[model samples]
Target: MLLLLIPGVGLAIAVGILFGWRWVFAPILGWAMLTWLLGSLRALGKDAKPPGAPADDVVATPVGTDQRTLFWCEECGTEVLLLVRGTNRAPSHCGQRMHERTEILN
Candidate 1:
């Protein structure tokens, strides 16, 4: 999709020049700008930034607000809380141990 942008603009400009009509540049430039903005938005969503200190205060809750368990991998320093279903094997990270994470009720 990124590769297509160049040819799209080039073709638009070429047709405009060949036909001796400069008005075609408006739509072509508009389309190019739209695609550029779309690409930027997509790139922004792809890169996930690490959470700051506020993440520690997050409480994981499922639909209906049932009392769900939270288990996180102690190996990772920024491990996220997990919701427990049935009794299953504990999660791990980087060959390190996993521990249950609890939140203090404020």
Candidate 2:
């Protein structure tokens, strides 16, 4: 997997084998620092969002008493019904958040 190249256990093992155990950490830490720097720069240059990530603008609000609410996942269209609670923490489904859609209950 591509994750094996992420300068973790594999690198540690290779460094420990090829060099000495003491020298192993030198490349590991160097790899970590280099990856962190490069990752930051790559993130700064990105315009497209990673898939299935939650929206940053969403904020949870408390639900009203004597009412019920429906929440739906925008990504997967999964729906949930809940009695109004003191506070609302929107539900999650399929790795995405479910948001409330207001409609008259009467």
Best by TM-score: 2
The lDDT of model 2 is: 0.71
TM-score of each: 0.28, 0.37
Location of the lowest summed lDDT over 10 successive residues in candidate 1: 53-62
Write candidate 1's Cα lDDT for 2-106 as tens digits: 799899778777888888556676776898999999999887776434566232333445655544456666556645456534334456567755676656543
Among residues 3 or more apart in sequence or in different chains, the pairs in candidate 2 whose N, CA or C atoms overlap within 3 Å are none
Alpha-carbon lDDT, every model: 0.63, 0.71
Q: Write the per-residue lDDT of candidate 2 for residues 1-106, one digit (tens) a residue.
A: 6686686777778878988887877766898999999998897667445789664653333555444578898887888876534344577698766888765655
For model 1 the TM-score comes to 0.28
Clash count, one per candidate: 0, 0
Task: Measure candidate 1: CA RMSD.
Answer: 12.6
